[model samples]
Target: MNKNIVLKAENINKYFRVPTLFHVLKDISFEIEKGEFVSIMGKSGCGKSTLLYILSTMDTDYNGALFLDGEDLSHKSADQLAFIRNQHIGFIFQFHYLLQEFTVLENVMLPAKKLGIKSLEEIEHDAIEKLRLLGIADQAKKLSMRISGGQKQRVAIARALINKPSIIMGDEPTGNLDSKNSEIVFSILKELSEEEKLSLLVVTHDIDFAKKTNRIIEMEDGRIIS
Candidate 1:
């Protein structure tokens, strides 16, 4: 494993047994380097999201190897994988998934609190700092539901950054936003990769968005075609 490789998947395969044992992924192998920004582009049901889930260590019912930061994670226990995810992987999705009842600051702090490695005060400070970085610090005290959709997505990005994970994975993060908001989010992600040296792997159907990334992994019938 290269020291600079933040994530690697070798000969990975997945199957769905409930629906007559359909193969969802086949020989999916790829590597994402530290500070690299990559995007996965594919048609619907091409298993791009499934591959991302496996890489993120959220789906372990697959064959082959998954390595994160040079550590093989193929056989870790569920609890162990959970801990690893909290500490090493950050995720964003098409929807923000913010808890409407919680304040923006609290929403951003939840993952750090779950890790239980920092004092509440320290976690709060870090959460605020992340919010500030996303330019949503002023919304910290407001309820998550009070913010607009664009702000909500920014809040989700802040929450993802609070843990400072080795890699950030997004599943159509800009899919739910308007063009302006989508561009705003994309610029933020690009800046994070350039300035913060963060590793980002995003799955998107938007070809324009995919074109802006460092590399684009195209998939068809569960295999990387290019």
Candidate 2:
């Protein structure tokens, strides 16, 4: 409930019913404060990604209380959750989910367009600024498919920043990149957290990546082990 806390998850638990019921997460409780860069590390199937989804408001079939920017998310309708996600949370995945046919600027503008709080010209200008912030403004006029993998991911990051979400959530954001590209992305994210006062919660298997974050939450068997 602290004003400085950007996200808080309390007594979170999850289960999957297919092929018999299976417990996926257990009593996960944590808080991320403004401008803090945090990483979650664990083996596959340890529920790090699953937890991210729940925290991101993409998955609602779980028992827990999730708070973002002081608003409780439990029991919210799908549409309400969608608006919350669009307005308060930005997400990046292991893969850049850019539309191949769209130009980089268009891709970055999509989320802000959905929010519909700004005019077209304003959105375009904001998108360009985000691209410039990521050092990819020159690529904005090109189709997403024409860019390199690293460039595409930077476009994704730009897209995620378009709305100035209170927190950015990434699930193995650098998983598909080479070391050079990965380091570039990491530095970009780190700078955003420190300089822009943006909160970041990243789920990564890369030990080196986890080590560089402000804090690391290690998971085992669906529980935070450290």
Candidate 3:
């Protein structure tokens, strides 16, 4: 494995037993390098989202060897995988999963707080800094329910970044936003990959969004088509 590679999946295959076996993913093999912004594009049920889930360590029943940041994750225990996920991978879903009752700063600090590697005060400071970097510092004191849709998404990004994970994985991160806000979110992600040297892997249906990424891995019928 190259030292510059941030994630690598070798010979990945997945099957679901609905009644009989249904193949969900073919033998997928790929590598994402550090500071790279990559997109996975495919129609619904094409296995793009399934692939993302497997790479994120959320689905381990599939046959594959998964590596992140030079660590092989083939047989790690659930607790070990959880720690690796918190410390090495940040995830953003289509919907902003912020706790509506929690203030923005508190939402962002949740991951770091759970990791328990830093003091509450230190995590609070770092969370604020992440929100500031995402240009939502003014909303830090507001409850999540009080913010706008785009603001909430940015807050999710802030939460993802609080731990400074080696890679950020987003599944339709901008799917729920309008075009204007979608562009804003895309630009911010691009900037983070380029300027901050973060590795990003996004699963998006928006063709325009896919075009903006460094590379696109297109899948069809559970196989890489391009």
Clashes within 3 Å, all models in order: 0, 0, 0
Model 2 lDDT per residue over 102-176, tens place: 999999999999999999999999999999999999998999999999999999999999999999999999999
- lDDT (Cα, tens digit) per residue for candidate 3, span 1-226: 7999999999999999989999999999999999999999988999999999999998889998999988899999999999999999999999999999999999999999999999999999999999999999999999999999999999999999999999999999999999999999999999999999999999999999999899999999999998
* Alpha-carbon shift of residue 179 in model 2 (angstroms): 0.5
lDDT of residue 110 for candidate 1: 99
**Model 1 spans > 4 angstroms off:** none
Model 2, total clashes: 0
lDDT of 1: 0.95
Evaluate model 2: give its TM-score. Answer: 0.98
Whole-model lDDT values for every prediction: 0.95, 0.95, 0.95
TM-score of each: 0.99, 0.98, 0.99
Least accurate 10 contiguous residues by lDDT in model 2 = 84-93
Worst 10 residues of 1 by lDDT: 19-28
What residue pairs are clashing in model 1?
none
Instruction: Please write out the lDDT profile of model 1 over residues 1-226, one tens digit for every residue.
Output: 6899999999999999995989999998989998899999999999999999899898899999999999999989999999999998999999999999999999999999999999999999999999889998999999999999999999999999988999999999999999999999999999999999999999999999999999999999999999
